[model samples]
Target: MKNIRNFCIIAHIDHGKSTLADRLLEYTKTIKITEGQMLDDMDLERERGITIKSHAIQMEYTYNGEKYILNLIDTPGHVDFSYEVSRSIAACEGALLVVDASQGVQAQTISNLYMALEHDLEIIPVMNKCDMDSAMPDEVEDEIIDLLGCKREDIIRASGKTGMGVEDILKAVVERIPCPTGDENAPLQALIFDSVFNSFRGIIAYFKVENGVIRTGDHVKFFNTGKEYDADEVGVLKMDMVPRKELRTGDVGYIISGIKSSREVKVGDTITHVDRPCAEAIAGFEEVKPMVFAGLYPIEADDYENLRASLEKLQLNDASLTFQPESSLALGFGFRCGFLGLLHMEIIQERLDREFDMSVITTVPNVSYMVYDKQGGVQEVHNPGGMPDPTLIDRIEEPYIDASIITTTDYIGPIMTLCLGKRGELVRQDYISGNRVELHYKMPLGEIVIDFYDKLKSISKGYASFDYHQAGFRPSKLVKLDILLNGESVDALSTLTHFDNAYDLGRKMCEKLKELIPRQQFEIAIQAAIGSKIIARETIKAVRKDVTAKCYGGDVSRKRKLLEKQKRGKKRMKQIGTVEVPQKAFLAVLKLD
Candidate 1:
């Protein structure tokens, strides 16, 4: 254990975390470099050019004529996948804080840095992309010094593309980061930081052993689930799972117990010997809090059970996703799913389609709210349809967030305008270094959950980085806006909006739906209403059959009779016709400007 080092790579999105990881793997000769971003093996990850999952691999390096075992966990840098970074941090003793040479310290860089510090992990700062034309290593070096308080020489300037300074990074990992420390004689105590489902192998759990030894064929139990199973196999992860006789203290490896169900395993659970268990489960395991909520209904009602099964298996891989059974008046049986943010929600939908072959309809996304009744009873509402009658409610409070935006000084005006338009209150502002400024705002989570980040990037010319956390709720003038099709309320199309935005939001919803919902045989009236009052309305003209066409060149009275008969027929058809809201109509709300 004294010759082992466990560390992870941390940085902002697209800041070369995976590229740097590739260079490290190549330098260690762990595997042949056949493709770029070998760590991001998923099709979606490569297609989107983002890392959706954290990958861990073991490598052996020689330094000063001594062989050292190194385990590197490459982490995702996007804010939506921050939970993955936290889990990776829990399994390692050190982190490589990579900052792009051009785009110094970003919002996610600082946020992830704080997470590492909270875990007391040794941090080694590395300036990547040093070979780029716009590389500003010295300026970024100063920025890193200001943020981390580390000396200039402590930072290693490297280029993942050219493999420049890659050797120095490995040397720093050995010299600066401390070795994994624990007692091997103690009872078995291993933390299951991550796990994945395998079709033939059942479920494979990857863990880090903190104490004692785990041998193949040993009986083990997960503390969280309190379930026991036989360890069918145990081994170290090196690109491929390498079978081992036993895994001792300070070792990262995978265990296969022939578990058949995904529900049997939980991430962050403790693994202990069934005969000689540890004192207690590992403490300080953080639960993920979902920030945005939306309805996910299978396109076919019979697919409900299949959808649930897929979600359960997907949750095994992604612990951040949460869902509960729910039924919508328009969409039939479905689940009300909670996500981290807009991007997280989109990724979940795409994964369901690509990974599970499940077709689903996602309703308008919103944040949870607190509703207090006249009797002083408080209830939390995730869907607008579950809200109590407004007459019996005392007040409604919506979720808010403390938003931080890091950008150059030039885009401050447009950024402020965008925030103010969303009813954001300025909390404070400070200068980080040079022309870079950090602005903090207290904004409603509902306001920014949709397209605020996209707008921020657009206005800042892709230079602004944003991050936020939920703040406590405060009472506000809120009303539930219900969308009615042909005068019948559609529960799946309703949403809760602040009173000041109710009319405008209602009108926008009406206008957007008009363009997405296909026109029916009879005229369809789309109305947005709050209780008994209609706030906005739109009409989709029917494909008129023109009963008068046959009466052309006929007597005036005959044409009038034909038109009146057609009008009566239309009125009768409107009463019995039901509107089918296409999936595009449900998704159009997300793109509302």
Candidate 2:
């Protein structure tokens, strides 16, 4: 226990967290071969060039003739996956705060630093990417000192790409970071930081043994769910799962107990021996609050149950994902899943298809709203179709967020314009170190639901680092905008938006829908409406068949007769023809410029 060091890497996205992990693993001879971002083994993570999940691996290193067991959990740097970072932090005694030497002290960097401090985790600041020519080590060192209040020598100047200062980092972990402190003889108490489902082995839960010891074939139960299972296999995580006879206190390892049902295993749940359970559950683990809500409907209505099971298994892997059963008039049966942001939503949709074989349609994302009826009762609504009628709704309050953006001084004007265009109010600005400024804003969550982050990145030329936390809902002039096809409302495309931008948004949605929805045999009128009032409209002209092509040089009466016949046929078709809203049309709301 005294030789074990548990630590995690936390930083902004693309700050070389994975790269640094690669260097450490190689230096310790954990793996004979090396690959870029080897910790990010998922195909999606590789293709997207981002870490979507936290990966845990054990490495043995000899320092001053003393071998140490270093349990490292490399975490995703994106804000959407911050929950993963938080869970990783809870299971460790130390954290390596990786900040890019070129791009010093971004928003997520500060946010992750605060999270580590809140958990009382010892922080070892590592200034990564020092090999790059554009790297400003001195300036970034100052920024880290300002944020972490650490001395100059405390910061390790490392280059994940070139393996520079990699030795110092490991040395710091041994000398500075505290060893895990828990009673090995006490009742078994472990915190499950993460879990993954295996078809052959059932659910595999990775946990840190805080107290006591867990041995193979021991009966253990989860404190939260109260389900007991025999530890079929106990092991520590290396490049692969290395089976062990027992795992001691302050050790991080995986437990497989033949738990088939995903609901039986909960991430962040406490594990203890059934015979000698702890006095109470471990504290400091908080439930995640999803910021964005969207409906995910299976393409085939019959796949609803299968989709549910898939989501259950997926949820075991991703604890932050929340969903409940819901049905829509337009999209049939589905689940309204809550996510952290747009990128998180997209990743889940992709996973459903790639990992679970479930093809789904996602509704336009929105934030939950508080609808206060005339009777003074407040009801929360996540979907536009679930909203109460305007007559009964006395007022609506939408969720707001306190957003912090770290960018160079050059892009401040454009970033402000982008935020203000979305009705964001500037809170304050501070120059933490040099020309890099952190801008704070109070903005409606709905405004940034779709393309706000993408726009911020583009406007700042990828220099901006943005992170946000929810501020409680506030009263706003919001209205539900409904899209109608031939006067029939499509609930899947409905959205709740601020009243001031409703007209322009409605107009853009209509125009975009016209471009996406295919022209039927009869003319289709696409209209955007708000409570019986149409604010914007577009017409998809019918694919007309030229009935007069064969009437060349014919009498005027004959041509008129043919035209009249075609017109009557068209009229009949209009009455009976049903428009098929293509899948892209449902996604048009997200692309409205």
Candidate 3:
């Protein structure tokens, strides 16, 4: 048990957390059971090079005649999934903090490091990407000593991409990371970090045995909710894409106790003994909430049932997601869905396209808001469709975000100017480890709810990285604008905007919508309005010339030919009447740049 070590590989986005895990898997011979194998079992995880889900693996190795078991957890680097990262940190006794030798420390790295420290876990600093030409190990080491307050010799340098210094990093984990310290004789208790589904094997819950022995056939209970179940089987984390057998205390593993669905297995929930459970559950646990939302539906109304069923299946695996039936005057029927961030929204869209083989139309994304009415009524609105009457709104409050940008000083002026244009207030600036500087800004969630990251990257020539966190809500005058085409409000073109910029935004957004919409047989007048007042207008010219299928008098069949041509024209006219706007066109306006 003393030889067992549990640690998570922590880093910023694109800082090589997954790549380092791959190298560690090879070094520890975890994938040796198969030939030409990939360490990450999930296809999506490998393609993105970022860990979308936290997964643990068990591997054994021998050094100087002593065997050690390494339980490694790979965590997501992006800020949207910070909840998942916190769970991973709690499950481990220590962390391998991976910082890019070239890029040095970043905003997300600081965020994740603070989380690790809050867990009171031992930290083993590791510098990755040392093989790159831009690698600056000396400066990064100094930053670790300066910012993290670590000794000069504490940093372990390596490259997870090329498998350099990986074996040495593993050795450091065994030497520096402490073994599991909880009492093994106490009642069975484990903290659930992640869970997955098995068609034939039911639900598999991955957890850390924080206290006591966890054996097969022991009855378990969730401490807070008092929900009970039987632990039919206990097992260690394996890379086989299947369940293995009996994991003991001082080990991070999985258990399949007849949990038929992942719904019962919530992350951060405590699994404890049924008769003699732990006295208290872990504190400071909060459920993950979806921040932004949009309506998603299939074009064909017949696919409505299929779409709903598909979303339900996906939600069974991810409880953090929320969705419900939403009907539109234009779309007829659809579902409104909520997501954590832009990346989460994109991932869900891709999955719907690939897994369900369905065509979906998603509306422009919008953040949730708290609206106060003149009658002293308060309501929370997640979608513009649910917004209250404009006349009744007394005050509108929107979310604010604390944004940090890491960029070279050469592009500071341009980036600052861009932020100002987006209504961002500069908070502070400081010099980071590498010649890169960190600029802090307090910006409205609406400003960055669009293309802030894209503009930052473009201005900084892809060298700038941006990350943001919720900084609470502030009172503001906000309004929703409805774009109309030929006196009919297009459900797809409805969006939120500030009262100050509402007119300008409406004009630009309407123009972009018109550019995306094709010309019709009848001229379409695109207009933006607040309530009954029109603010801006653009005209989409009618098609001057259309397809003409003419036929000459052809003896007896001439009349029949004319009838066939008339039928073809009728079909074309019907197709033109039901012109459903595409999702890409609605999303284009949000791109701004």
Candidate 4:
């Protein structure tokens, strides 16, 4: 029990967290180096060079003839998967705060550090990528010490790529990070930080035993769901699955029952022995809530079942993902899916396309809105089409986020201008280093949901990094801007925008749509409206035919008759012709500058 050490690697994207994990595995001789970076099991992760999911492995090492059980969990660095990092932190007692020696501190680095602090975990600062030519170890060490208030000597300098100082990092973990302590005699209590579904074995729950013991054949129950099942198998995580007879207190392992459904065992749920159940559930085990919502429709309506199956299988691994059956008048039958952020949504869409072989059309992303009706009722709206009538709504509230952006001082003006345009309130700003600045703002989540990060990167020339978390809802003068094509409202093109910017946004959207929408036989009127009031409109002139071109040496009256007939035909077509809006037209509004 004294030799057990549980920790997780927390770092920003491309900070060498996964590489460091590989080096640690190699140093511990847990798995042969010939196997390569085995911890990143997902092919998508390997291709993208980003850890999309949190992974855990149990390794054993020997120092001074003393064997230590070192359990390390690797967390995703993107802001979208911060919840995974939080859950990983909850399962461990310490964290290896990995920072790039070249990049110094980044937006996600600060965001992840705060989360580790919130969990009260002991942080072991490690500077990685020291082999690079641009490495600035001394400056990065100062940044870490300043941010964490740790001693200079406490920071570990290591190169994950060249395997330099890897042994020292392992030794520091065993010495500085405390071992897990729990009572084996107490009731069985394990935290299900992650879970996945299996066809043959059913649900496999990965957990850290907080107290007591769990073994194969024991009857275990989920505290939140109150579902009981016999533990058919138990094991600790290695490079692969290895069965164990029992998992005692302070141990990280997996439990498998006959339960086939993934919904039965939820992440953040507590598992305990049915006979010796704990008096109360463990604290701080709230389920993750998605922050972004988007509609996904199958290109072929018949593939809806396949899409549904894919989502269900994906949900087994992604507990933060939520979805329900929904239909859009323009998009047909589809599922309204909820995600942590844009990256999460993108990853899910990619997986659906690659793994499931399904092509899907995604609507514009939106954040949940709280609508207060004049009848003293409140409703949550995830889609712009679901918003109540303007007359019945007293006020609307939208989700706000505390956004932190870190960049070079040169881009301050552009960053500030972009933030203000997004309705961001400048809360604070400070210099993290001689040349780096950290700008804090409170901005609507909706504004940030679409192209804000892209624009920020463009303005800063890719120097700025961004991180944000929900800051709850705030009252805002928001109105739904609906796009009308030839006097018909297109639900998929509707969006919620602040009243102040509605007119300008509507005008821009109309212009963009006009450019993307092809000209038809009749004139097409592209209009943007708030309720019944049209705020902006653009006209696409009808395609005309030269009926008088065939007239050869005709009298003036004959030419005039042919020209008049053509004009009348065009007027008739304009009165009755319906515009054929292509899919690109619907997506064009999403790319409005």
TM-score of each: 0.99, 0.98, 0.90, 0.93
Candidate 2: which stretches are off by over 4 Å? Answer: 552-554
Model 4's TM-score against the true structure: 0.93
Summarize candidate 4's per-residue lDDT along 1-593 as a digit string, tens digits: 89999999999898999989999998888888775457777788988889998999988999889999999999999888988888898899999999999989899988898988887788999999999999999999989988999999998889988999899898999998888888889888899898877778877999999999898999989998999999999999997889999998899999888887666877888999888899887787567889899999998899999899889888978888999999988778999999998889989989898878988888888999999999899999999999987889999999999999999999999899999989999999999977999999999999988788889989998779999877899999998999898888988888888999899989998988888888887788899999999989999987877778877895889999988888888888777876766766655666777
Q: lDDT of all the models against the reference?
A: 0.93, 0.92, 0.80, 0.89
* Residue 259 in model 4: lDDT: 80
- For candidate 2, the per-residue lDDT at 197 reads 91
List of clashing residue pairs for candidate 2: none
Between candidates 1 and 4, the one scoring higher on lDDT is 1
Where model 4 places Cα greater than 4 Å from the true spot, the runs are: 33-37, 518-522, 540-580
- Which ranking of candidates, highest lDDT first? 1, 2, 4, 3
- Please provide, for model 3 over 365-439, each residue's C-alpha lDDT reduced to its tens digit, 9 standing for 90 to 100: 888899999989899887787888887899999999899988888999999999998888999999875577889
lDDT of 1 by residue, 1-593 (tens): 88899999999999988988999999999998899999999888999889999999999999999999999999998898999999999999999999999899999999999999999999999999999999988999999999999989999999999999999999999998899888899999999999898989988999999899999999999988999999999999999999999999999999999998888888899999999989898876799999999999999999999999999888988989999999988989999999988888998999999999998999989899999999999999999999998899999998888989999999999999999999999999999989999999999988898899999999999999998878899899989999999999989889988899999999999999999889888999999999999999999999888777776585799988888988998899999889899898888888888
| Candidate 2 positional error at 351, Å | 1.4
